[model samples]
Target: MANFIKIIFFLIIVGGIGIYFLSQSPKIFQGSPQEKVSAPSQTFVSPAPTSYTSPSLSPAPQAISDYLIPSGFSRGQLSPYFEKINISASYAYSHFNPSEIKLSSNLSDNEKVNITGWQIKTNNGEIIIPQAINVYEPSGLFPQQDIVLSGNNYVNIYLSVNPINKNFRLNNCIGYLQNDYVFSPSLPQNCPTPSRSEISYLSGQCQSYILSLWGCKVPDKDSDSFYVSIGGSSEEEVECRAFLDTIDQNGCFRKHRFDSDFLSNEWRLWIREHILDSQHDRVLLFDKQGLLVDEYTY
Candidate 1:
């Protein structure tokens, strides 16, 4: 019975020692308790991709940089003569002082256009183009004729009153009147020189005097010294004096009126008062029917 009791006591002691060693030793099933606890402390998460989109913009306005179009009209709605006959855009402003405006014709197909009743409407007011002599005659009654435009012709419109009491076409002889009257945009002084045939008829002293005189220039009739220098007592001197008298503008026109180039390329029209603004202005051209021809702005 004692041996059996001793055997039971030894078995109980061995089981207690095994239980104590297992509780005290480090764990090895998967990992240590500390390692298992620290694994979840740090975390990693990948970022998601993004999509792109484009922006929207508005369209720009349409405009013309050089000239202005009236509110009710489009460029295509204007007359067939729209750009064929046009206002002079060379000035910054079609100003009042020195007060001149110009109209030019640029017909491509060799057309003849009469601009007598055409209107130039400015910011100030409007003016009708009047008639003028086509070929001016110095001796006859002045007759106003329709101002016509042929190949490459231009008209100079003056804002002041007519100086000669009439408008007339300029000829080679027009320069003679310039001596007594002031013409705005002065008349050209391109009178024809004495013909070779005429010069051959004059005496040697008269020839020298004639050659010394300038074209479109009258001799100094008032200078007694000049008359005496030409030897007024002599026959040659008398003839030379007579010839000098004929060197005036009227004489020039009479001699060369039949020449092809006697007429000038420009026509001058006087409007009888100040017409355009000095600083800012808008000029519109209209046909006789009041249709828009062209426009200018400053």
Candidate 2:
């Protein structure tokens, strides 16, 4: 009986140790349907870059031809000659002076004389005559033995020698006189001869006159008067036209006329009067006391 009990005790102890080991072992479960764990889905996307382009440019308009004058003529050198004469005399004549000579027959009353020589004496009492002529005129009567006259003499003379210069003073004088009346009809009664500056401005008119006395370019709008661009710029056409429209209520652009003739001394006086008035308006002021004041700023 003792041997059987001892064998039973050994069997029980072995069963107990097996139970302890089973409790301590890691437990692996049969994961409920083993849900397929897929790697985190990765999505790839591409972005577009922005594009840029330059804008096209337009060319400037060509200038008008009518407003343009020939530039080459502006710089040209024009030399106009008057008259030059060399005189030879065989007769033994005494007491010769430019004043004593009958220039009344040689020149018109309106004509002027500008004499320069070894024999001439100025009205200012200056002796411009050279020493060579002084020796010839020891008696003071025969001032110069050999004399050369050079100037614009208004009259026609039958010269021993036909004038050395064909372009004589007569032609120039006639041209000046004729055009003077045509271009500026409102000229003064004692109209001064046209100078280089006057001729330059009036030459275009003279040329037009030569074409036809009445050949003025008619305005596009059929007006008797028209606007003249003093600034000489076609680009400012819109601005210029607007300015003209503001000043001209009558539609025709006539110049503002003064009370006196344009060339008279009275005209200058009138200008002075208006100038003072304009300046007074610009600088004058009124005080609170209703008195006139000269100060520009309050």
C-alpha lDDT of all candidate models, in order: 0.72, 0.25
What TM-score, over all chains together, does every model reach? 0.69, 0.14
Clashes of 2: 0
Q: Which stretches of candidate 1 lie over 4 Å from their true place?
A: 1-72, 75-77, 89-97, 228-233
Worst 10 residues of 1 by lDDT: 53-62
lDDT of 2 at 87: 17
Looking at candidate 2, what is the lDDT of residue 227? 37
Candidate 2 residue 84 C-alpha distance from true site, Å:
16
Alpha-carbon error at 134 in model 2, in Å?
Answer: 27
Model 1 accuracy (lDDT, Cα): 0.72
Best by TM-score: 1
lDDT of 2 by residue, 37-93 (tens): 569999988778775421110011122132321222221111111111111112112
